[model samples]
Target: MTARTDQAEITALVDRFFLALDTREFTPGWARAYLTDDARMDAPVGAKRGAEAVRTAETALLRFARTQHFASGVVTDAAFGTDDATASWNAYMVHVHHSPAADPLFVVGGRWEATLRRTPEGWRFSAMTVHVVWTRGEPPTAEPG
Candidate 1:
């Protein structure tokens, strides 16, 4: 594929990932669809390896009644290898909950860096690092009532 085509594909993959998360449909199948088997995700707390681990971490964040992830200003670099690429994007997100009453709990502005691979199934994230540059309000938690 041409460089332009590759970049488009990468961008789409990134968008799909965030959309899936926003919809809270992060099942194991969803993880396998978007990430490599041994993918690594480094977040504020730490890092998780493999699709299962990543799924678990994402699932925990579902404590919020609702969430949305939006990515913009995406930039992608395609390497010589057909399957290798890298991308960076800014993410604006909001987390909301309604356990007691509905309210917006947090506003997170973050950056994402990802290493991608074009697997037989299509492009998948090999590794991703998320840095929370700034956030307003405390992050929500799933504590026992």
Candidate 2:
């Protein structure tokens, strides 16, 4: 595939990933769609490696509360290497929850850096790192019409 096509595919994959999480669909099949077998994820809890580990971590996270990851204003930089590529993007996220029952929580905009490898399964994320800019909690308010 051409570079543009590859980049587009990756972008779609990233979007789907966040969408699935926001909808609380933590199925292994869905989680594996974008991550490689050896992928690793790092969060406040800790680091997890491998597809199964990633799935487990995600499931636990979703159980915390109802969440939505709004990935707005994505800026991607794709670097084509000999056999693989790396792409990074910054996104603005609003993570809502019902724990406090006060206001929806917002995770300030953050950056996502991923290393993708061209594989038989198509472009897959071999490594992903999420850098959070800030976090704040707001009292729950009526949903906007």
Report the Cα lDDT for residue 49, model 1: 92
**In model 2, which range of ten residues has the least summed lDDT?**
136-145
**What digit string (tens of lDDT, one per residue) describes model 2 on residues 57-99?**
6654554465666655444455556557777777766655645
lDDT of each candidate versus the true structure: 0.81, 0.67
- Identify the runs in model 1 with alpha carbons over 4 angstroms from their true place: 100-103, 143-145
lDDT of 1 by residue, 93-121 (tens): 88776465444578889999999998888
| Structure candidate 1, residue pairs in collision | none
RMSD of 1: 2.1
Top candidate by TM-score: 1
True-vs-predicted CA distance for residue 56, candidate 2, Å: 4.8
Backbone clashes per model, in order? 0, 5
TM-score of each: 0.89, 0.77
Candidate of highest lDDT: 1
